[model samples]
Target: MNAPRSLDARLTEQRNPRTARIDQLATLEIVDLINAEDRMVAAAVGEERQQIARAIDIVVECLRAGGRLFYVGAGTSGRLGVLDASEMPPTYRTDPALVQGIIAGGLDALVRAQEGAEDHAGDGAAAMDEKNVDARDFVLGIAASGTTPYVHGALQRARERGARTGFLLCSWPSEALMKTHDVVIAPLVGPEVITGSTRMKAGTATKIVLNTISTAAMVKLGKVYGNLMVDLQVTCQKLQDRGERILMATVGVSREEAQRLLDESGGHVKTAIVMASRSLDAQEARQRLDAAGGSVTELVGTLPVA
Candidate 1:
């Protein structure tokens, strides 16, 4: 039987016959070679920083305006999307539903391999419908070869319905599949040291891209304060301690006074800063942050550093 026409079936332009013999090397040498190649991934990503920043700006705007962010993929690519979506709530206090992931085989794929799942295009469409996805959000698809059925299906459908689309895959310019999205970030990391096991190089690239997408988007949404996780969860005592310190340092209040204002603001870090720095009450602090669009820095960057 002829193989399916896929981005995978497509040939890579880099012709390095030496890499095919990578396994014949001593184990240590092979590991060293792989590690050496891995270093190039960051440089590739660095070159795409502007593209990454643009995606972040668009996604963050949707999020703050009450829109959702969706990730779609298959296999290792799918798992990476799930991992990023799962982390946002705990790390940045986002509503879990607002940031979501849809893998080809559903949640079971995260634990065990679901090889057949990748072939089903209907699964991709069904998953998006199940989530009520629409023009109000953004969809970022992941397909290392830039041609996973599930990823392409999602992006195509997203565009059909007026939802903006973006892609994080391993490809280059002039690939027309690249043109379907508002932004295309194909961090061309070439091939895997182990060949066909995209779970290696391709997976690493996917994770790095997802990390950049979510973290930078959150930062643009005012979820960060001068590199500190200003929007970090206050569900634990450690977070409570950190929040109090942020209050003290940003407001220039004595430690004792900072704690007092933190208590007064009900342990909300941004509000506490407003009270300590601006002498505003909890209600007033809330208003100030709202007025500043949730950016503590914008709300108080003019204040003397603590």
Candidate 2:
């Protein structure tokens, strides 16, 4: 029988020379060492800006075509994927089905470690079937080591269904992986401070990458106006406050008038902005937004001076 390949060659599995004596260091020294290592993560992600940007463009295209985006992974990668997917609705008022996260071991694995679940390539393929993935969808596989069987399997199945595939890994990807995915975002964050514990730097890098992809995609979809979350769903007091404030700032309305507009638009910031700026009723504002593809600025043409 052939011996298993050693993970020692992987950047994420290698030990850091700078922290070789970490065990013997004082508390302050240990903190400083970790901080220094953490500082390198941003630069590593920066090096992959082109790939990340390409991933965003792919996501935007897929979504605009009425398809969805999926993030597939296991363990910490899975958790991060779920976290990013679940935030889309409240943050940008996106439909729940538009962005999804598929983790190995199912929802039960989310709270517990399902280390063995990631080994079954067939189960990953099954998941693609469950989602009814098609040509319009985009699937992104997240694996810190760039060797998760489940992620690769799902990506393979997604490709078979004619969907665009993407890969996000912390370690350097092999030629096969790069060739397989439509876009490859490999942020080489090096080894974790606690050796193979990738929930640290690798986790942070994944969060940043997902944030950029989702936020940029939403912006392209007209979920944002300028720098504000104009499509936010005012489901609670904080968001209600935010919605009114967004109206107050953008359409040059007073706080009370902003609240009235928010009420008029049923808590939709973008619609409220359109109604206030264009001097239209809720239905008229909605029609204008629909005509302009949901862009408040596009429909209103210009913001009223404050």
Best by lDDT: 2
Mark the regions of model 1 whose C-alpha exceeds 4 Å error after superposition.
Answer: 1-18, 172-174, 253-263, 302-306
* Prediction-by-prediction clash tally: 0, 0
- The TM-scores, one per candidate, come to 0.87, 0.95
Most TM-score-accurate candidate: 2
Number of colliding residue pairs in model 1: 0
Residue 188 displacement in candidate 1 (angstroms): 0.7
> Candidate 2: deviation at residue 144, Å?
0.6
Candidate 2 lDDT, 210-306, residue by residue in tens: 9989998888888888888999978999999999888878877899999999988988999998888778999998898988888776776654544
Cα lDDT for residue 171, candidate 1: 60
Q: Candidate 1, TM-score vs. the true structure?
A: 0.87
lDDT of 1 at 144: 76
